[model samples]
Target chain A: MEQTTIRFTLNDRPITHAAMPYRTLLEVLRDDLGLTGSKEGCGTGDCGACTLLLDGKPVTSCLVLAAEADGRKVTTVEGLAKDGKLTPVQVAFIRYGGLQCGICTSGFIVAAHALLESNKTPSEADVRAAIGGNLCRCTGYDKIVRAILAAAYDEGELVDESASMPVMEKPLFTEGPM
Target chain B: MRSFKYYAATSWEDAVAMLSKNAAAQVIAGGSDLLGWIKDDLNGPGAPRADLLIDIRTIPNTSYVKFDAAGGLKLGALTPLVTVAESADVLKNYPGLAKSALSPASPAIRNVGSIAGNLMQRPRCWYLRGKDFACYKKGGDFCFAVTGENQYHAILEGELCYIVHPSDTAPALIALNASAKVVGPGGAKDVALDKFFIGPRTNVLKETVLEHNELLAEISVPAPAANWKSAFIKVTQRDVYDFAVVSVAVAGQIEGGVWKDGRVVLGGVAPTPYRATAAEDALKGQKIDEKSARNAGDLTLVKARPMSQNAYKVDIAKNLIARAVLSLASA
Candidate 1:
């Protein structure tokens, strides 16, 4: 396959790079662009380690071709934070310790970010359904669910009268690189 | 994955021209299934990898869902599974399809998997997917699942192979009586959803009847009639993001607990979406109660020949079919 010049908006910035047609987005992001935040647990779509937002929807980056980026907007885990301020989801993960091995954290954060953006106040079922694609074998999904609920609460997105409310708390060692 | 030449097709006609020009060319809509298939190197029956890929997603006006009350629903081949799952019109008319669309892999997969891609998905046989096996589905000497790990193999139509079709939406679409539009080098033609799939007895190399030079263009589903209710039930190994063990999709016209002519399509039990005509025939003009529904399920699997390990699937299918019918009847 002939290598073509691929152009797309990545993390709110326009990018252009020469890439082969058979190369995947995850490969180009990690190798060429130095955006190594996204990990590749499985090259296939079964594992959600290489998830990113394509046009505001969570899609497995490993399955998407580089050319399909497609002249469209792409959002990786690095794009979630602004300046030095962390998003509620990220902070909640730190405080709640939602990850164990931390390989699936970035993908979960990216997917959960899309969920919150679409639905500000999501229920527990909603949270589970949105991040269902992301697999975290280490945490058993309890703390991860708690972290997402706590994040939604801190973001003022959780406003349900029937479900139990999660209280936000401060945890030690808040300053860290994900 | 093998390296392949790529061309961004501008239109349907251009895509056809590109496909017709290259013998090893294949059109890609979503790339979700195709990329994974390429990565796995599972070319069904030892077909060569597509050396040239024609990206039809670059073709405009191909990703849309048009709904008309009288004329029914028309979905472009490029329409994403998430779009179909969340469409207001589809949910209103055919909630079973929405459920089936959402029932695959997960939200991420559903968000990008196209309608035609879903229908054209290959079998999920472990022997076929793995490169080391090279089973019968991959044109090897023998089918490994016959005497080795036949847990997930087909229970009904295991002729020379024991592979089960992996498309959840196909059963729902077949129950809804959908038709697919195919555009090839010759011209365009419509194929009924049930007739579109080819079993292992007919040809194990290809799942759909589409030729190498053809591509699915659109899917059209007839509108539901008055007092029509439909539902889908899928028995999976896991709670979410798993393939069906035994899935049932039921659509019929029922009034006051009396069910008329209905359609029952089963997935994860055969090489194609197997229609339970015996169940449909037995349920005609009958009251859809627990007993009647159970009887219908029995009739559906009356001639099923279960494999050694997959005989459990027969029970699961029977229970699922009755549950599906009862759910719709109660609705």
Candidate 2:
């Protein structure tokens, strides 16, 4: 069997990996690349633990073959935090207590990141629909929804305020929308 | 996973050639189901290995859905589940089909998994999906689902195989009377959705009419009639990506509040998508009032021979058909 050599961009860096024909992207991410953020809760696509972004679209990495990802851009939770800074959604997750055991955190964060990227002002229902696939055993999803909403508000403000204030470290303006 | 030869098809021609060369080869676009089969060792012990896997996700045209001059819908086999669910054209013309596509696996899965893969998904029978007892669906001597833990087993079409067809989109397509275009070594051919399924009696080893190395290229559905009204209703334990305990998809023309030329199909209760001709007949020339809908739903389950543990499915099936009918009636 000839190994399929796949070259793709991961975490804003180009990388090449050799894998068997049927090897899933989850295997390539966790086994070959040692990026354990994407977990495989269920080998089938039911569980959201293996969620990642392929070309800016959220998809179950466990279902996507690594060979299919050749020359395509792949984004994992590791890619969300740029320049050693937590993504807005991640910060909100920590601040709002979005998770408990954190087994499903990476997948949730990935889903949330996708939501915030597309929609700046996502309603609670929108947030719910975005992360509907992710199941959390401990938190009961209240904090997760709050975190996503808060992140959306923060993202909306950041986009608006960042234009005025050059190089401001803190994103949240306390005096803005409550 | 056992070692298997692999080929990444750079083009559709290359993919067809690869499949033509190896009869034992399996096409892997999204590894969603195939990976689980390998990880669980669902294939029988000492089974003939699949020595070749052709990756078709790289084929550009195979991943797009196009509108035709005939006002029909064309779905490339590799079109992702999310695309099918969210396509405006699909939602407008085939809401039932789109809703089935949106049955909600994890967001990530919907994003990458193909609609063709969903219809081609292996049975979800725990016995079949699990490594435990080799059920009859897997060419075993006895069906473990028949007498043991048969809660999720099929209610109808259980004589030959107790396995339920896993695709949520399949029942909707069956209701729409869709056709699948198959491309293989022999060339292209179209098959009706109903005739596409092969029962266990025909070949215990195969699930669909697709021959070895035959690739499902496209699925085409006719445009909805001017008076067409349709709905897909699924009863599941959860709101998310769970398979329906029982589901119904109905499409028909409702004129002056009377259903005519209707097609009703049930899912999750049979080996193939169960078409309720009796129910269709009952509603064909009748107005879809609550009384008539309930009566028609009663006819839907007339032929249902549910197993002892799956008797609840009969009631659920009835309610699903009723609900789908009422929804379509209101539309």
Candidate 3:
């Protein structure tokens, strides 16, 4: 075995860390690089909770080997905001109440942000396809989809004004049965 | 999760030489499948421990999709599944192959998963991947899937183990009559997709015929003839991101409202891509219609022996076969 030093552009910052060759990018990001924004829900590729943008494409960082990230551009959820201002995706997620537990929020936000970057206006199906791999047990996905669509609407130069979904206003039961 | 030596291979020759030199070394491009295996500690009879990993994605000129008149189609092993699914030439020439590529886990996965890696993905059988279950796929004596939760297990060729093939592209590639290029220390060689997969009967622990050091370099699909029509359809538990419950890939040569030649392949049914040769022969001289397609589909699953909990797969597979064939007939 040989000692490998991994150097890559992470979140617009050059990070040079000494990590094991078999370590995943998620482990290195959370443990070594001290970037814990990316959470590991499933160590496998099934869950997108560990999603990151590699060269502007969203991929499950849990499956990407750390050594493979050398000389590549990697973007995590921490890099979304700029100048201490929340991005549209973050604003929409808050306005639309896209998440409840917030464990899967970062991955969803990262995936949606990547989608909006590629396509200014994404259809409902497009949004679904983009975040299809992400698994969120709390949110039923309706709000998330709505928030992404709303973000797209905002990007089309429309004012973000609407009585969007309330945090918890939907009544499952209108009246008690006699 | 253990530390292992790594090398970024610059060329196929370097990769082969490295692999041949180190018996504990393994080759990986996307690292999606191999990392999962290593993290789960899923080492069994044929699932050897990878003490070293050779990164093949560093090899230049490996991600490409080229199609020409004489060569038909050429896909580099490292070409991302997303690229293959969205390629215009692939969509125009081989729609089934593209559909198969798109039908996998999700866009994020397809964005990083490689063409050859998809074929090399291990089965999702709980017993095989689970460290607790001592199944035949993990070099155990008995198969827990046969008596345990086997709703997603094999129904066709449940010889020693009942693990169904997890690859979505293998069936479509076999239906399209594709070939794979294997590079190794012995040099490169071509293998038909049909012969590439070894079933549980021959080797229950392993999936493909690739030796320890061999790598699937590329996949080449022949161009379709004038009247050739191909289609791939999958049925999954989840709508967008799940493996197939049952899938059918149909390709045929149609002339004069009759199918003179055809190939029918099924996924998530057998250990390997189950080639329904009987159904293929049955549709050879038949005028493909609703009734004839139904008959062919019935013939396709006639030999199926579904496990206790998976009898529903038979009906689903039959219906998909009919639908895929009928769609091809209309195409």
Q: Rate residue A175 of model 3 by lDDT.
A: 44
DockQ of 3: 0.71
lDDT of 3 by residue, A1-178 (tens): 5557988999899988888787788999999888898889988988899988999999999998888788899999999887656677877787767899998999999999999999997998999999999999998898898778878876432223334533433322234320
Q: List the residue pairs that clash in candidate 2.
A: A59-B108, A60-B108, A60-B109
Q: Write the per-residue lDDT of candidate 1 for residues B1-331, one digit (tens) a residue.
A: 6888889999888998887788878778788778887888756444557888899999999989999999999999999999999999999999999899889898888888998899987777888878888776677778889888889889887788888988999999999999999998778999999899988789877778888778899999998899888898899998879999999999999988989778999999998999999999999999999999999999989889988888899999999989999998778
In model 2 chain B, the worst 10-residue window by lDDT is B41-50
Instruction: Give the DockQ (2 decimals) of all models.
Output: 0.67, 0.55, 0.71
Clashing pairs in 1: none
Candidate 3 local lDDT, B87-113, one digit each (tens): 999999889889999998877889889
What's chain A's TM-score in each predicted model? 0.86, 0.86, 0.86
Q: Best DockQ goes to which candidate?
A: 3
RMSD of each: 4.6, 4.2, 3.7
lDDT of 1 at B66: 93
**Shift in Å, residue A54, candidate 3:** 0.4
> Docking category for candidate 1?
medium
